[model samples]
Target: MGRDRANIRVDLWADGDWRGLSMGAQHLYQQILTHPTLNYAGVADWRPGRLAALTKDRTAADVQRDACELTEAHFIHADDTTEEVLVRSFARHDGVIRHPRLHVTMANDFAGIASTDIKEFFAFEIQKLNQEQPELALWNHPKVQTILKAKARDMKEVTQRVRQEEAMTFGSATAKPMAKDPNSVSMRTATATATSSKEDIPSSEISDEIPRPDVDELLDLLDSCLLANGTRKPSRNKKNREAARLLLDRDGYKVEQVAWMIRWATADEFWRANILSMSKLREKFDQLKAKAGVATKTPSAGFHGEIDVEAVLGRDVWTPGTPPEGLDVAGEIAWKKEQRNIHNAERLAEAKQKLGIS
Candidate 1:
């Protein structure tokens, strides 16, 4: 019969294993044990999603996690396919097993259990109860024998299935295989560098007195790229902020160039950990561009307007570096720098004029 009332031990709080359970799991355990419809057999419906809907500020995932924790702790056994739970100690603790008169009631409740896994667990507990209290003498009872025989078949099927799985996969002993989805966010952590050779760093001096909004956007992009590359989030304090501002505003580095460097450095096996800060990024921009195989290469020739590698590596391995025949590599760099200086001058002049600065 579904119990109208449930008994709880006060010493339960003092139990180290019980206290070790997460508060959510502990709450769920109590909820299940005290449920008004909890049957004599300790088996009950375990619908995490439906239970979550009736609770405050808890999702189905939270309930599912709690259920798993309880199951792992051996406080309960849950069968996902059957959506049912068997509280391991319910019958013994509730005095049902000790009272031989209650066996009929327990058998009636057992008939309603749909989970073979739960039935197996329940039968094992009954055998233990019989040994602990031989006076009850339930070991050879018709009901106990029937439950044991059913679980025996269940165990045989489980053993056969495990054997078949072992014949199939290398990880048959493991619970599950690791994820292999290519497009998933998970990625191998490439090497990361926290320090760079200071001698190789360029002087990053900011000329503009005001903050550049575009530079801040570039810093945000760098942070996002770092996370995407499976690296820890890089810091974005004012020191790095000013460095990026100088890189774009005074050093003539284009926003697109900085964006490309940010992505390449974060994804590169060697550079991912090293160029973690904007100061490092700005100081070693030329080195990064060269390592990226684009120091003297034209910017607008490759996939999505990046460096054209075909030009770097000639049309054929035997041919000389193509570089877009007669493309003045040095002249191009100088011209771009000169244009950026002119643009910056115009922008500075406009700002000064607006601010009435002589």
Candidate 2:
């Protein structure tokens, strides 16, 4: 319920549920999972008007439809009569709960709900857990055991209907139970997160060869490059992280390619002025590549009237009508000398060829 821990873990299970959901539904589901108060309890008052106040894009009807989809997918449970919604798997954890007290407190809160459907659903989940996870301490809790026994008949009847509904909706009675080891589930989930390797990434039938950048290293490199090129370092935020993730993880840009582009853009007088951030860098990446292609190829001999000192020095070493920055002066002089030497050597070779020297 605290804003200090607003972020929530979005496991890879979402991929399966996403298939039948509309974009609006997925967004609403995320809102439910991540909303500060709702995230902690995983239960919310399902008043349509109340929910509509929180979701501007969705009407009350849309909210109802989305909630139904989530229920059909077994992502959540909603009782229209009581207006209480519950995320079915919210209390389920693959591993030992990090904070048992907090998790226990939250579970207790849900257990106290005054709705029959909600109580039955929670009791059924507890029974399922007891069967699948006999080692878990929840099964040993006297109160939890009592609740399961007390609701035994209702839980059995409700669970059977829920399974039937699931089969009718999804062609399956229930999602495959997760393995006991949280690590196994985490390993599978890893494939879906930004850090996934080539093998983990799903293909269309099913996913790229470009090595994903180490996110930390990539961000550090961005800052270093910006600082070296005299740009102020910007604070890292969600938008910046997203941009970098898209370019490196999703867009298949190599880390080196990103570094090269960042270097090139920040040194190009015109581009340096425009591409001052990672978002801008991602936006102009193709243009930077095209420009780099032109620069690296170098004009064929005698094909140019004006020398592009920028191309020679890999930076804007000469600005029109003014002396270049002192930082570039040394590089400019060295580049010009190298160019003259190459030009002279070429002429000498041509002369020797004319004179029939082997």
Candidate 3:
């Protein structure tokens, strides 16, 4: 008798667009009458029968409308209404700043059709909203706010647990000292050799013979090594070794300085075992020096070195140009003699022309 239950529709709109006009009236009535308030707050302890009853007559329109209204109410009380805190929260959870469509699809399991263009579209939309309507921060949305609050509480508990575990593990490890094996002669020999090598190296040789690696060359080598390793663990150790070699070669840095520059945990240990390996240091230094010499000989390198604004402008300031002081007077004199010979040849040609010689 109630208009023959077959025909009914629920009108719903989201983001200012009509979602759909076709929905069963009975479904709409059931959703309104049986919707649980506790469930909205994420208390999912509802009995199975009650949940089934609530979904019995539900339509896509009903779900969309409810979602929109719930979101709007949450954001209504926020200082920033347009903020997409939900998207931000999702990104943080996933540990990515931005992803292409394929990534997003994989992450969300194709929540909808995902294409590269669609990903770009969403990214652009988010950027525009954040920039133009920052007041709509995602924290304003009820669903996002609820999720964020729960996440915060969970994170705090997790952090506390982790700290407690770490402390206990550290205490146990420290309580038992590593027992020294009475029969370990190899380690003793190695330590003895390292110490002897350090003592045998003369101070004057260490100070006067070593040369520092050029910063650019060191950087390139580090980059190559890091790329090959594909991990940060070896990178630090490699950097320390390279720095020690450079300082040892330059004769300018002490072992402590080398350790400090490379951030070694134990400067004494590094000096004892590593810096004393001066033969390897010399090899690396020679290779780097040869490469630098070749680069310096190239025309491009010459041009780059000669184009200094200060040098060109200050050429007449009477600064010494020699290795220890001013330019070589002998070299200057030889260059002038060559110029004079050229001038004499030109004069002889002019004299021949005046005499009408062929």
lDDT of each: 0.58, 0.50, 0.28
Spell out the clash pairs found in candidate 2: 202-207, 203-206, 203-207
Instruction: Please report the candidate that would top TM-score against the real structure.
Output: 1
Off by over 4 Å in 3: 1-225, 228-242, 245-282, 291-299, 302-358
- Residues 262-289, candidate 2: write the lDDT tens digits: 7666666445544545655665566666
Show where candidate 1 strays beyond 4 Å.
Answer: 137-141, 148-358
Task: Identify the superior model by TM-score, candidate 2 or candidate 3.
Answer: 2
Residue-level lDDT for 278 in candidate 1: 80
Q: How do the candidates rank by TM-score, highest first?
A: 1, 2, 3
> For residues 209-315, what per-residue lDDT tens digits would candidate 1 score against the true structure?
56677987898898887667544454564446666776776677778777877877666544554565686677567667755555432334432354433333322
Please state every model's RMSD to the true fold in angstroms. Answer: 25.1, 25.4, 30.6
Top candidate when judged by lDDT against the true structure: 1
Report, for all candidates in order, the number of backbone clashes: 3, 3, 18
Q: Model 3, residue 358: what's the lDDT? A: 38
> What is the Cα-based lDDT of residue 218 in candidate 1?
91
lDDT accuracy of residue 253 in candidate 1: 71
TM-scores of the candidates are 0.43, 0.39, 0.15
